[model samples]
Target: MPPVSQAPNPTPLYPWGVPPSPPEKSRVGLMAGIIGGVFLLIVALLATLVLVGKKIDSSYPPAESTLTAPGTLLDGHYKLAKDDSPTLGPSLEKSWRLSWDAKAVHGVVVAYHPSGGDRGELIVTGMYGRFRNTGEVRSRVLAGNGSRHTEVKVIVAPMDVTPSGSRIRVSCEEVTRSWADGKALSYPVCAWADGNTWARVAYMTVYTARSLDLESAARITLQIRSEMVKPIK
Candidate 1:
């Protein structure tokens, strides 16, 4: 019998007759790796943000059980007068009332005349309450400043202040507004918040020559807040 003809060897598709992975499979693997990497990165970022938030929350000032009126602050440079007048005008008061909670703890409007015979005054209008949202309240107070007044010129935009104790968050502004006497006067205004207590301060004077810078105004606010707000026992 004739020997069976051997089948001709087929041409090898690759060097060792083994083909590489398909292009589609390789693409799928690459995409999976990229997606996995992105997922991990996002998770890491979120974890970091959480850690930072926790740290910030821990560093905040201790919560107070109630608000206080210390009557005076800054070594008697400021005095909480018995007569709480409407020094900030009706429109601003209305805005504050709308922004703050109705059942707030302590609300007051007092003017601090220069302990000496000076003609300038610092008006502090504020209230203490549990703020549902501290940041929103602060922003609203800042934005609503001089809202209905057309003759107001902003001299210093709102800015944050870090006082010595780090017990409060303070923002300040400076503006020139037309007075009822047909003259323009500059005012240094500041807002203070500590998640529980909030205040608005305005330094006003008819003596245009005497001026208080925004830094001074912020410092004054810090002193006032430190004196007025006390941590619960």
Candidate 2:
């Protein structure tokens, strides 16, 4: 009997010609890893921001100091005398005598009574008598070292005195702009007050400027308030 011819073994297929197994499982795992990494990164960044905000909050202290000087009275009776310019410029020059009744209205009185003006122009023209019963006033707060000084921006609100009584309350907001740091800063001593015939008082808040510290701002505010006196009544 003729030996049955063995069927030629099928040639092994080349691996290169075979379709590769789909990497579906690996792809799934890789995606999961990428997503987890992004989530973790975001959480870390948020935590960092929280820590930074807390640090800033902790830096400023409360403003408890009273601005009213002892023995100072605000009963609407006093005199104003013109004084030489403290710093030389075009600003009107004047001082005060305790005898004048601080109620009479004058152009200078009306001008400085409100809370807006140019520093150079303020020196020359005095304060403008725009009389802002509403809106806000911008004031300067002093900060930084003696050699390197900075200005802090402050906002003051007008008060309602009454018919025949001239009374205004200036409130300082915690928000502040800085000339030195080129950024806005906030502080805890965020509130301050100056009313007619009353001591100026400052209230602290929970924020402060990065460049212009709260203390510096308060000092500058005090100086500005001191310069302000109502015309003799």
Q: How high is the CA lDDT of each candidate model?
A: 0.67, 0.33
In candidate 2, position 154 carries an lDDT of 39
Quote the lDDT for 158 in model 1.
Answer: 85
For candidate 1, the 10 contiguous residues with the lowest summed lDDT are: 96-105
User: Could you give me the TM-score of model 2 versus the true structure?
Assistant: 0.26
Expressed as tens digits, the lDDT of each residue in 96-199 for candidate 1 is 55543322345656766666565766667776655545556665566667775677777778877655666566787778888678987777788876667777
Q: Which stretches of candidate 1 lie over 4 Å from their true place?
A: 1-67, 85-106, 148-152, 164-167, 206-211, 231-233
Q: What TM-score, computed on C-alpha atoms, does each candidate reach?
A: 0.58, 0.26
- The best candidate by TM-score is 1
C-alpha root-mean-square deviation, candidate 2: 19.6
RMSD of each: 10.8, 19.6
Cα-lDDT of candidate 2: 0.33
Where in model 2 is the C-alpha error above 4 Å?
1-24, 63-233
lDDT of 2 by residue, 1-233 (tens): 99899999888788468887876668788899999999999999999999997765444222222222212211221112232224421232122112122111112311111122211101111222212122122221111111132353334332222223223333333333355556443442222222222222222222223343444544544444454544433
lDDT of 1: 0.67
lDDT of 2 at 90: 25
